[model samples]
Target: MIQHSLDALARFSAPDDDQLKALHNSIISLSTEGCGPRECRALLNVFERFPDHDGDGLFSSIVHLLEPCTGYETMLIKSVGPASVPFNALMSDRLLNSGVTEVGGQSLMALLAAAKAHH
Candidate 1:
């Protein structure tokens, strides 16, 4: 879960160091403690810059905190409810597995699509 969170965090641009790390911890805490989606959303929302994300800034973030990857199965995208696990979380794992770049053409939409599929 830590690795997943770290991978998700990588998609974000902290410019300054440690900001993403702090966000990662907050998200994990929210998810593991079973905090409401509002809490989870707040934590994730803080790190993302939103529509300003070079297009439709997509997925990423923490769910299992700093411990091992035990609770990933229980995590989900905040607004989408627990049913839709963050595509970023899945993408982070895909990225580690070299699944991202192998996705598609040079188009941004294609890339996002691939990330979604692979994840």
Candidate 2:
């Protein structure tokens, strides 16, 4: 299921408005279908790496969809890995200030603290 979505995304070199909308719909569908932690991580990686052809609004939308997924905080931090400092900074800022759900926010904070301790 995840691979199908990823493949659909990969096929678009330069998606038009309709294509983008379709992608958005697909993402919404994926959320409804339920994504596992590994699948969510893969999706996050792809979304984070997506070229900012639309000022990153698409990426942000995609991230929002996965925000409620299980193990999202752990997958989000793991998705950061050791690259893309700018993306990491953006995520950090979002995590710090965004109006995420209370449980989500607490989970992210706990993961961040654990990561900090390990590093």
Candidate 3:
């Protein structure tokens, strides 16, 4: 999991320094054992920012981080439930209105559709 997480972070080749710093800080703040449940729950809020990502690489990185986990089904569902709302909003705002460039190779609507399909 840690290896995957590191790989996920690496996908964001040149993230904004401040955003990267905040993400790093948040990751470090999570107690692997002491507050595992709470940290897991917090992932929902964190992933919600993915759709609003202005950086292609960073968007891919966030998608990789949110990839479906085998035994972590409960955590995954909980995380996606809250994240879906803002994520969908972002998609609608960008894809249905603004002419913002797609992230990496996928459009906002396509990404959201894929995410919903995964769920």
Candidate 4:
């Protein structure tokens, strides 16, 4: 499932506009069946491709798609609650070093802030 999502994302990011539309449509189909954390991670990977990827209303749209399907807030609470220091540290490490920073740090920070706000 995640592989499918990644393929779609790659197509969406390709130079061909028609391929982008097809990939977007495929993503829509996947989202309709209800996505999960894996799908969210895949989408996040795609969103990290550009410094401005999180801008232009794309990040919000991704979060909106993920929030409902993933039950993200509840999962966050359930996964580690508020007191899991190790979990937070690991998450912070992953988020900070996530590939997005190779292009620009600020956008990644903004994305992190947005994700936290969503939570």
RMSD of each: 11.2, 5.8, 11.9, 11.8
lDDT of 2 at 61: 66
- Residue-level lDDT of model 4, residues 48-92, one tens digit each, is 444243433444455556545544433332232223323322343
Off by over 4 Å in 3: 1-16, 31-35, 54-72, 81-119
Question: What range of 10 consecutive residues in model 3 has the weakest lDDT sum?
Answer: 64-73
Off by over 4 Å in 2: 1-3, 10-19, 51-56, 85-88, 98-119
Q: Pull out the clashing pairs in model 4.
A: none
Best by lDDT: 2
Error of 4 at 16 (Å): 5.0
lDDT of each: 0.39, 0.59, 0.43, 0.48
Off by over 4 Å in 1: 1-15, 47-59, 62-119
In candidate 2, position 73 carries an lDDT of 62
- lDDT score of model 2? 0.59
C-alpha lDDT of residue 36 in model 1: 44
Model 4 root-mean-square deviation: 11.8
lDDT of 1 at 29: 48
Clash pairs of candidate 1? 1-69, 28-65, 60-88
**Top model by TM-score, which number?**
2
Cα error of candidate 1 at position 107, Å: 26
User: Could you tell me which residue pairs clash in candidate 2?
Assistant: none
Residues 87-115, model 2: lDDT tens digits:
44356557668754234334555544554
